[model samples]
Target: MDHEDSARFAFLHAAPVIGGAALLKLPPLLGALGDGLRGPLLAGSVAAFVAAYLAPRYLARHFEHRALIPFSIYCSVVGLGSLAYFAVT
Candidate 1:
């Protein structure tokens, strides 16, 4: 792909990660704002975002192949567990 296409592709991959990080932080962020803990919360949020962004890149170096298998397994386990829980209830 050309430069612009590559950039778009990168952004497309990144969008979900960025959105997830924001969503994960949103509830606590709003609570912190209401509680007047803006400064520390904002700092912590930035640190969390940076770590989240870098973690995959760091892990990719070690798990070059089969990087997604663990995630898939975890997801499958969670899905099955949720289904079992609801069925029991």
Candidate 2:
């Protein structure tokens, strides 16, 4: 496989795993927007997007292949971190 093929393979393998994590992370802020805090949602969503994208990117760099349990844990941990951050300050 060439570089493009290899890169595409990596991205395809990771898409759903990363997507699962990203969507979960987004809900907290998006949910809040629907309930209230509509104005700040743009900022919140951006922050969540950046974090979610970056987290899986970082994890994928280490893991290469996406394993289900680890991806789930990664999502949960990121969600918890987002919640904790919102909780604290």
Candidate 3:
């Protein structure tokens, strides 16, 4: 797929997560936390969403010409660590 298709695919995948969090998760969380904390919680959630949305774009530019070896190594370590943890547990 081209760049537009890739972006559309990313947005489609992300929509469900954002929708689920806003519709299914946020209400219960807000209720449990009470009115006093509602503003801060919502603000924090928006900030987190913005950060998550923007971070990849920023990182993509920074790593545009970099080697993928570091990322591959990091993924391997995490995957093995997870496997080990699950096997022991």
Give the range where candidate 1 is weakest over 10 consecutive residues by summed lDDT: 1-10
TM-score of 3: 0.68
Q: What is the TM-score of each candidate against the true structure?
A: 0.49, 0.35, 0.68
**Residue 21 error, candidate 3, Å:** 2.5
Cα RMSD, model 1: 6.5
Model 3 ranges with Cα > 4 A deviation = 1-12
Global lDDT of each candidate: 0.71, 0.69, 0.74
> Over the stretch 3-79, how does candidate 3's per-residue lDDT look in tens digits?
44454467668878887767986677678557687888779888978987876675556555665578789999999
Better of 1 and 2 by TM-score: 1
Q: Over the full model, what C-alpha lDDT does candidate 1 score relative to the true structure?
A: 0.71
lDDT string for model 1 (6-38, tens) is 434675688788789879877876784557767
Look at candidate 1 and tell me the lDDT of residue 76.
100
Question: Candidate 1: where is the Cα deviation over 4 Å?
Answer: 1-35, 65-67
Candidate 3: pairs in clash: none
Better of 1 and 3 by TM-score: 3
**Which residue pairs show collisions in model 1?**
none
Better of 1 and 2 by lDDT: 1
